[model samples]
Target: MKEKTPISLHEIEGVVVGHRDGHGFIVRDDGQPDLYLPPNEMRAVLHKDRVRARIVRHDRRGRPEARVTEILVRSETPIIGRLLYENGVWLVAPEDKRYGQDVLIPKGATGTAQPGQVVVVELTEPPALFGQPVGRIKEVLGDIDDPGMEIEIAVRKYGVPHQFSEGALAEARALPDKVRAVDRRGRVDLTDVPLVTIDGEDARDFDDAVYCEPARVGRGKGWRLLVAIADVSHYVRNGAPLDIDAYDRATSVYFPRRVIPMLPEKLSNGLCSLNPGVDRLCMVCDMLIDAKGEIHAYQFYPAVMHSHQRFTYTEVAAILQNTRGPEAQRHAALVPHLLNLHDVFRALLAAREARGAVDLETVETQIVCDEAGRILRIEPRTRNDAHRMIEEAMLAANVCAAEFIASHRHPCLYRVHERPSADKVELLREFLKALGVPLTVPDAPGPRDFQAISKATADRPDAPQIHQMLLRSMQQAMYSPHNVGHFGLAYEAYTHFTSPIRRYPDLLVHRVIKALLKDGRYHLPVLPVPGEALAKLAKRLQERGTSEAMTRSRGRPSQEVLGWEAAGLHCSANERRADEASRDVEAWLKCKYMREHLGEEFTGTVTAVTSFGLFVTLDSLYVEGLVHITELGGEYFRHDERRQELRGERTGVRYTLGSKVAVQVSRVDLDGRRIDFRLVRDDAAGEARPSGAGTGEPSARRGMAASSLRSAKRAGPKANSGKSGTGKATPARATRGAGKAAGAQSPGSGRGRRPRG
Candidate 1:
């Protein structure tokens, strides 16, 4: 074997990013600014190819320019695109469009792929200084308009591991179709308990079931709650082929019309699923709740249970609404049990409120897709009492699991949500003060402080923006071996223990709980040495989630601590990957849906104000598109970053968040996942009003002024005394670039090379 050369200090390695016009840039791995690669330098590299380069000199724009010295690795991910033969040349244009450069498929390399048909291509040779990258057709994925084609493309584009390994598939196939007698050994017999699964109407895999009944506790009214989660760990042991595959996915990816499950169908939808009338093995969190909705005591155990019924959210909601109605009469035996669950839910809700949990109501939209995978409508998903009941039950169970492990002094991955950082809290306070609704977030503010702020702005016309700002001010929750407690839920400790069939961390939690119940500690698998790939994943996990301090805590044994840290990092990174993949698929679908409504007019709310333009979300379609600042008016508009609004300098006309506007669909770029809208004026002459041209009211301006002052105070050299002027607060729009230069081009239109040093 040839000896590989060691990387030198000046020789940096990074991924190649290409542009439409054949120019490229090296996104350095060391976090330095990207190095410009002109057309000549890019001839040797394709988009996403890893290469080692050296900064030879500076470009005319004073940006660092690099020359490729070696090609380190070619991306193994297959590219999905359409095959086209033009002028005796065969080429494949990538569906993602990020590839920038097209792949050349020779006549003999075309395989069975037809012209204009979608196909997966494997790179046969990296691009050379004078040639394009060469590829061979690996698989035909059908036509572009075929059902679920978008999903197939998304999975490939995001590099989501959707296919199960052959070993995992074989293992799943060999497993019993149903729970066997041997599987019931050493498990408690709760098959007679009327536990039932409550899920969404379209739900297929039932991961959890719940049952509640009245109980006597020390001369007081109490309730016995049984939360039985599908015991996926029993079938898929640690380090097994199934476990490895599940860990690679970490969490299931849910798209509008399809789901990429963490486990094979045989496990997630069959044996491990809590289907009605079937005896399934489960890990039960049995709790005793007082009348006050406080969990007095809890225990975990392995059990076998039969689900009495599988009810949907709508069915449960209707039954709860009217106990004597036809829906309730149909299942009279389960009615009383459901009623008890509802009663316990109300108590739990009261307890939650008393605990000062951060409860903010926000609209969640669901895309309704037809059999052909075309979006029919976008509707707001409403939550009812049934949803709350199930959520509360899950929360109680999760809390108990976290407590069980903590009390036993065993390290485990916790579902952690920390409080907002100091800087974000300061910005929120300043914004609130400008709106005449000042918040007193103490040095050590809790969820209650956030709840108070939410309540004060609940009735405001700009409540959506305010709530959005509040949400942004908080940190995203992630898995961590260190328990900082969940700030949003007002829990001292919390972990995900339900739905192990879909979430890898939950399965790990179940195994830990089971081990603790058997009077032992569950040790995590020994992690392999942190190699280049694993280290990169760990870095991404740290950046996307909790800080490094939480990843590896203090006062823990070396090997045990390292094992938990690795597990936490892996789970967190994969979770983020799943979310990004799902969002990418949804964005693609939404873009496709909006392409049909081009040139149509619709009324929308200004959900975001950027220096470049306004982002309006339509009322009827729930689609959000940008109305670039140039389309705002003929006059000059200035972006006020502090106030989060765009002010037309000439007329003083302001366009802040929550402002309703009429818009016409101007353009849609499916490749870029971008939608553009043009403003539709309702006044005479159909022209937009200038800032101060026709309107004499300066109320909005005054509010903006107060907001500006608050901003200045916070940015001042001296310490802020926490005082803010009273005025109607401006809505905090989505944080996007706010200037004409920033708004001049859509991301899709921008080239790979940016003016940076």
Candidate 2:
């Protein structure tokens, strides 16, 4: 008899991610592949709960399957869902299907929430092997279709801190409405600088103001530029109630008609805001630039500045276009200075080009909502010279800030954007080669390589598609104490220093710069945040330590370095969180808008192609929906990864990234934030029908749709009819933009810019 060896089990700790289906997975904290948990193993755990699991066996597909060993932490996040009663029992079905389990609500635990109304639930008992989780209604939010309900649900669903703590609110209330004398002590007076804020029309929190004038740089023709950012650190002290609340939120969340501010309105919109004709404390980045647009020298200092005016992008652009026009006449007193700023901007732009920074253009849309909180329309936002000017100024200031900190050997967070991974670069090269584009992508490419490709393909019909692929090939920028340089911006060092009023990292930057100015080191206070809040951050820091830049550094990371790393991770994660919440609200709004036009046909461009379907963005409405593979035609379609397209095997019809098509909206799943579209075939009948239908096609081809429907039926009614082109459960928000052009917007700037890379 042969003795069999016992299977060695691997134990892992991770957060539970539940699917709408009975199955779930453990998203391992060690950055390894997720371990699948079948319906049986998921019985005793809920979504987002921390758990330690052991790999019991590998599935037939060679995937590791795990069983729950212990529940380390039950997620305290409140669940947002609708309260329902049926079969002599009350329960709440979570709005976010990821929760997977219906929470049972006992009698009297439903509170004031009515049946079918959306409510917030707090778990009272964890799920057992054979029982559903039990919870009590914690807050009654209102009807599912009420105005602003999406925002309400999103804030809670994503755990975004929407309400200010009582102590923070009290502290804000006690602060003076105007800058006081003591607050301005030892600060350089910049009230005479004629600094003016340039922002969007609806901007409230004016975080940055700029002033520029012709000056002598070592007896050469040059310009002196001043970028004064709101000093949020002065008002929100470290570890205070306001600071704690601000840290919790990390960044302000912007929606269509609302903003969930990081700090209270008193700080975001009043005292710290550089409102026109008001004295405000600021951190100034004063730079001397010569004819070439390169910085000759720079200095940072605390300042008391008064914004001479607040100009919108449109107005500034109009004035710059024609100094004698009506728009220019209104701001005649500031015309000459504006021209100097324009000259300096041109010089800086030249420098940017010389540095070979990646500047990919993308379309950004703004949602127009009416009084009822319903979307009226979606309009493409325009960017002009004024926007670019402000962007260049902010960029220059940020670079200087990074250099200043590095010079002082300060342990502060740097905005890091590393080069693309080898795999992504290879994929991009193959894609470009498949398209027959006359360009070469090297294994180790720099910002110049990408910029060159963008320049070469600018006139192509598929330029937007190619640009999107380039953007996707790059890695997302993040905050880190270990500076690896910003690949997208082509900067050796960069840090966010312009919008402290909205971004917590910028506030930290202000503190560090202040400490450096005083010839002292800034010590991070023991944050009031929980250890769990930083668990994911710790993992990310550990991962970052393996980067090439980190390996090149000398010594073991200090406590301060680790603390800054944690802060960086927290800020980066919250930034993404805010983005997700905003996108959710937008998607919900778009779904509602599309519902009114069901069965209507519209022409659109195929933005993405996957094995399952094509994602189409309507030209007129700017709304995106999925055209499932089953609805493509009666023929089998095979996805071509290299070409980024789907091709019919029998019929020669092909749909690529830039393909144009007309589709009729078939289904709208508001709950799922999904919209399904059926292709409108071009036939003599001139009627909307699934492609290749009604023809003498083979039975196998004809039965494709039926077979897909049958499969969907077997999967259950709640199964998502179609997924995003990326194979994600939900359709991704239409590509907004990326890189410096798409970076997060400063308070007074144009469309928000994403991190350059």
Candidate 3:
């Protein structure tokens, strides 16, 4: 008998990504190109599953294909979805669109969840090549329109750690409600220092209190600024349950009407919160700022301080605007200190400008939610002088903390914002050139150069697009053990030390500072070795600039440095996750709100011009929707990549970024979180191209010849086909005067708009 030869299979680990159309791909952890997985192969695993796959032959597209050999790790995370039954089959459709497949529920696996009811499902059986994965309802999250349902879905959809572990809860419950005398033994007693916390009107957790006064330093007079941060490290010791929970969350996630706090309320809003009229233990950064706004000297120490008052931003802004106002008169004694703080803030602002910080003015909107968690309104959140003053003070304190640790040669997570890459600079230059804007960007541009471009284009018709492109060119800020300097703020060094109550990195900074004050070194608890797949995934995420996960270098390092590196990666990744989760909740809420105003007409500006469609933001509603190319009139529109515009092939009519037009709310897909608009008027499309120039035609009907029609078919008929009579029904004539002589409106101007006042 001939011996049977064994076939050796080469396997690699990667994450599964399921598509809405039932196909799937394996995003390799090793940074290689994604491997294609047909629908047949995807039946064996679910999206986000870490699996070991064997490489199969290449597909027709020359793409490496793979088949799942072994499921290394199931997601195990419960999915939130709505229960449905059709044709004697029970299934759960995930609320998050990223999960493409539905879970099969057995007869009794539905638990107490009824049809159309939202519930959390836990997988009971892993998927097989021919059978669907079976799951049982684990929790009932109530109806879809219940109060705070969006937030609930977001928290679960993004895998946010919402519920505190029993151990963590117990540890928090056992903590004292106030600063004890024994705990303040070695701390400086600044109880009568008259420091005060200034925050928003609705703020509950006060993490910082500030006080400033004129003082003499060296050869000149300076301001003595004291910033007292809640001493979270004192309560959450290393390796404790509370500390573990805080580390897991990394940072608090804030939604419109809710906040998933890092620490339990017992600590975040009680003992560690620097509430007014209460004595709280704190870590203080005492700085002597010269009249020029430079920190001449600084010191850090542990202290017990009492906040004399809690002032809101409105009250402080009113007092600063007019010191003799009623609000200022009400806090007569604190007025002098407030004025001193404002003076210091002015000096700091001048210094910031001198340092060449990139200051891009963006209007931030805040959602005002009612008691039932429905959005009452969304208004621009204007930053007043009081807000700026507090921010400057915090920035100064953070800089001092960073400098202190760096001087001590201690490793800690620094807030780093690296300069833009070479490719980004070239893209921005090309975009600017296409818009006929001057490219004043330097070969190696700093914040000042970008700032110049923004200032020069401030009043231009395409200023919004220009500013947006510039902003997108910059890298996101991240926490790293290495100090790469912050490009946006133009700071040499920076760290977070003021918000320890909500941020884990700030707590670590507080711990390191306290250790430095005591002439000791801070030590981190031992962390388990990260899995090979996780390390590779983290490295890939870091390289793609999508996230900073477990990205510590594999090089052998001293225990302390290794600890700091790992902590930095974890904190950075969690920060990004929190942001994604918060945005998901907001997007979902916005979609729900817009569902009510369907079919209404609203004027909007072109925020982004893509080949597929134009993304427009309504002037007064502040809601954004996509105007598909098909709805841009009965003409084939060709995308101009560099110019960021869409031009009609026949009429040569153009729709560029920042162009304003009237649009009627057409379709709202709540499941997809998408809104679509149809042009109510398109005079913003500009004039037709001359007959001889390019492929310009006088009318949509005569424009598409045999050759042109063939070319249009390649770009998708729904997108580019505009043969008027040959087309079915002529697309309803574009709402009568939709493409009439409406004049163009410049960027940031509400021209041609009839938005609500």
Which candidate number has the best TM-score?
Answer: 2
Candidate 3 lDDT for residue 321: 94
Candidate 2 on 1-757: residue-level lDDT in tens? Answer: 2232223566789999886656788988888778888888778998889999887777544567788989999888999999999999999999987677899999999988899999999999999999999999999999988999999999999999999999999999999999898998999999998999999898999999999999999979999999999999998988899988888899999887889998999899999999998899999999999999899999999999999999999999999999999988988999998899999999999999999999999888888889999888888888899999999999999999999999887888899999999989998999999888999999999999999999999998788889999999999998988888999999999999999989999999999999989988999877754555477766775765655434335545566666887788788889999987888888888888877876666666777777667777776787877776656655556678778877766665677787777666677777767776766654564322433221212121221222344333322122124332332222222221111111111111113333311
TM-score of 2: 0.90
Clashing pairs in 3: 682-738
TM-score to native of every candidate shown: 0.84, 0.90, 0.85
Candidate 1 backbone collisions, by pair: 435-728, 435-729, 611-738, 611-739, 651-690, 651-691, 651-692, 652-691, 652-692, 653-691
Residue lDDT tens for model 3, 273-360: 9998889999999999999999999988889999999999999999999999999899999999999999999999999888888877
**lDDT value, candidate 2, whole model:** 0.81
How many pairs of residues collide in model 1?
A: 10
Q: For model 2, what is the alpha-carbon lDDT of residue 156?
A: 96
- Worst 10-residue lDDT window, candidate 1: 748-757
RMSD of 3: 9.2
The list of candidate 2 runs beyond 4 A from truth reads 1-7, 59-61, 528-533, 537-556, 683-757
Worst 10 residues of 3 by lDDT: 748-757
Q: Output the lDDT of residue 137, model 3.
A: 94
Backbone clashes per model, in order? 10, 10, 1
